[model samples]
Target: MLTLTSPVETAFHRLPAGVKLGAVALGSVLALQVTSLAGVGLLLAGLAAAYLSQGVVFARAAGRQISGLWPVVAVILVWHGWTGAWAAGAVVSGRMIFAIGLATLATMTTRLEAMLMLAERALQPLARLGINPKAIALAMALVIRFTPVLLDKAAQLVQAWRARSPRRAGARIVLPVALAALDDAEQVAEALRARGGL
Candidate 1:
């Protein structure tokens, strides 16, 4: 199968689930300590290397997502530079992006069942707080599973609208897309309930 999950994800999947989670969690924590341009640059370079090492496909996907957000990043950098806070801001932004990319890689590699298992195991200590960890994990898995479906449906609606009219899409198009996606979500929920998900 042509896979959305890249070789990086596949490799991460072989590690114990806890290890994958820890890598992301630890990386996130370390991001806070980066407060210089050098730090941010190094972090970005390392993340790029990691993604590239995974495979061309993963690197492409990561590049596209990062590129799409370049405008936002530029605005942040400019604002911080004006305030003489460029170093701190860049570090914060770079770490957040890099950590997210890594964590996403983990999710792409790990199956839903494995994610749930890890979630359940992690939440075990909190069970005494009246939290149903399994339920929470299952809910998260469902959300993850449906996110891309929702995005694709919305994209399709936008394409259809663009085809029929040359006018720029506005809130009118977005509102209907949201409603349609909700309806699809409802249908999915019904199916899941029938299968004892509820």
Candidate 2:
């Protein structure tokens, strides 16, 4: 699995994972409450400044991670445009972009182990209910880690499709991506079993 954490150290990397995660959660909530285009723009500007503070390399890496949002944004804009609600579309898109940016920043700065530890601690109380905190935390960590891997797989499929055909891959790659994901899951399950199964 490819880790989202950047190899280049930054000031944000020194912060506790819990704090960073909490901040992202709070920011997401606030972003959702924002309805005005101006408000969303201000928040996005602040987020951009935060990224800039981390240095060019770190900011560029974060931008690449969130680049996946473009398609979704385009869909949102198209739908809103058809409905004649351009302002609403812009606000919605901005809020989503800001929330994802905040999350990407946190993920890029924090280590997977630290996030797992934080999750485990947060879920400790659930242990009394016969729920394994370690297992739950590990599951959460794996989901975070594999999301980008799946996206990369989809990208690879698209590239392969383009290599042979002039047309876009579009939905044609869905089945292949699903099968690939299943294969990955099976391998991961086997690896977990070998390591004393979560």
Candidate 3:
């Protein structure tokens, strides 16, 4: 979906957004209960099967996204190993990753418009709390719209750093990525303001 525009995405886009969001949320919450490596393994396999059956490019995207969180994973592994809580840490980490992976798959298999609609319906009950569900939905749509843009910018920054690096420091890469992300944020703000969202 990110690399090319395809019919699968178009088909997924026609589904009710609320239904897709519900599925994603339910899958994520349920996945938390599965902590064992075997369970997570099975979940991954299931996701892969679904991805293949649906012809969605989830495996590569999910792998790229998951591997990007290795720093956090590394910290948890070291802390747990040293503190003698490796099993607990592993369970927490696995479940967290599983939820994220499943959620990503859900998004990849669904459409943004459907997601926004689902979010609006889901938030409808909160209207009594002084929340306008439609406004919240629009905000969510804007976030989803920009998430890919930011990701693409980050990828470009990484590639540029790799092209120039002999010894790449974290700060050198992160600083530029952060600045680019902030620029994207400013553009998003400007877009919203121009559309009267501000």
Per-residue lDDT of candidate 1, residues 104-143 (tens digit): 6665566667768888888898889988888788777767
lDDT tens digits, residue span 11-92, model 2: 9988999899999999999999999999999999999999888788888888888998999999999999999999999999
**Best lDDT among the predictions, by candidate number:** 2
Residue range 81-160, candidate 3, lDDT tens digits: 89998887777777677667666666665656666677787799999998899988877766666678777877787778
Off by over 4 Å in 2: 148-176
TM-score of structure candidate 3? 0.66
Candidate 3: stretches off by over 4 Å = 1-16, 55-58, 148-198
The whole-model C-alpha lDDT of candidate 3 against the native structure comes to: 0.69
Candidates 2 and 3, the one with greater lDDT: 2
179 in model 1: Cα distance from truth in Å?
Answer: 1.8
Cα error of candidate 3 at position 58, Å: 4.4
Ranking of predictions according to TM-score: 2, 1, 3
Report the lDDT of model 2 for residue 149: 91
